[model samples]
Target: GGTIHIGYFDQHSENLLDAMNESQRVIDYIKDVAEYVETADGTQISASQMLEKFLFPGNQQYAPVYKLSGGEKRRLFLLKVLMSAPNVLILDEPTNDLDVQTLAVLEEYLEEFNGCVIVVSHDRYFLDRTVDRIFAFEGVGNLRQYPGNYSLYIDYKEVEAATKKAVAVAEKSKETSVKPKKSERVSWDKNKQRKLSSKEKREYENLEKKITQLEAEKAKTENELYNAPPGEVSEVQKLHEKVESLEKEIDTATERWLELAEINS
Candidate 1:
């Protein structure tokens, strides 16, 4: 059976080593904290190598986990989780205290991970980046499954609410049999969005493809950065810059596409 790993760090952990600086080095923490056998890939890896590759270079290699900043400790915990090589990862509020850079890197790692990931986070951006499915808790101990990322799910919900309002208005008009004036039909008026022009339609379609390409490129560049060797610092830096530029472009394109979609509605 596959293992389920919960990547939760107890802030108030009472273990003796957790209190002391026994795991004096981040490398030592990684080696001792998680249980694992050597990977079949036969790739020789050292703690120093992982530190450099994950952008935690120089002094960070030997820094004690207890002495590290909150962000650093979070990153270290994440590294330990990865080293454990579990088939399923369940992260509870994984974004707390993590810097933007670390978050981005972790998102990239999740994207390329071979196993399933179940993430619980209040960060909309993080949810949009890491998950395609969500289990939302409704009242009365019920859980609802929503398809797509957080942004897409939100859009779906808004459209659904508008549709329901329109239906309710129609049903009420049927029961009353009083033909309300145009201005009185508030729900209809509210949802009567503008239609798109031919040019706008074409632009929206093109943007969809372009945005997909950009996203794929961004993910690829992120993986490149994650897998970059210690000596390929320049290559990694260039890839990072490309990812940032691509993200901005994608965001602009996505926003324009959304605007066009609203008009098309």
Candidate 2:
């Protein structure tokens, strides 16, 4: 097997703190990992410069580790891990206690990281921003792999559920059609009389596909909004409006689908 170096960041910082000297300044703690680390673009950066990049300014870098806030400690731990320059990074609930600015910086860092990242997080926006594939746990000992981001995975599951429900409805209809009572037969005749027209039937068949497409588009737009650079206020607003519009479209199509399904049944 090939050799792999793993850098891990846990949500609970106590374990990491116990291994560190509390009196050490943040810069010293980071320098202990490395005096300088190379960036993705081949330039080497000093510990202080790297700390600044991670949102620790010059003043904050001189403070003792014990004086840092909970969120700051977590951010420091994350920076330490990154400074180690491991090939594989494992983050367990890395978002806990982290401020939004830190989270955004981490997201940007991950975008340029030249390594594999395995994250266990419940933050949907984080997952959407950082990951391209998902491993979803369905039940005990049942983990399934999906070949897309979190949003796309959710879309697939929803479509699968709808298809299953349609199949169940068709089976029930078949079972009821066999040897129905007189009143039941009359009800069946009424249902048949209200069957969907050719165009309606086509629309019904395509609604699921259409909804899936719309959902995917909405997911993409939301991701764009998340990654949009600062000061692009107008662009952000437009993306938000697009997401709401797609939501409305999905709702309208779903209602129409339900109507056609009822008529056909």
Best by lDDT: 2
lDDT of 1 at 27: 71
Could you tell me how far off, in angstroms, the CA of residue 91 lies in candidate 1 after the best superposition? 1.5
The residue pairs in collision within model 1 are: none
User: Runs in model 1 with CA error above 4 Å?
Assistant: 1-23, 33-46, 179-265
Q: Residue 169 deviation, candidate 2, in Å?
A: 1.3
lDDT of 1 by residue, 60-170 (tens): 777767677656666676677667766677776766656788778778767666667777789998998887666788799998665556765575455446545644754
lDDT of each: 0.65, 0.79
Q: Which 10-residue span in candidate 1 carries the lowest summed lDDT?
A: 8-17
lDDT for model 2: 0.79
Q: Which runs in model 2 stand beyond 4 Å of their true positions?
A: 178-265
lDDT of 2 by residue, 21-138 (tens): 8899999999989999887888889999999998999999999999987777888988999999988999898788578999899999898887888989999889888886678899
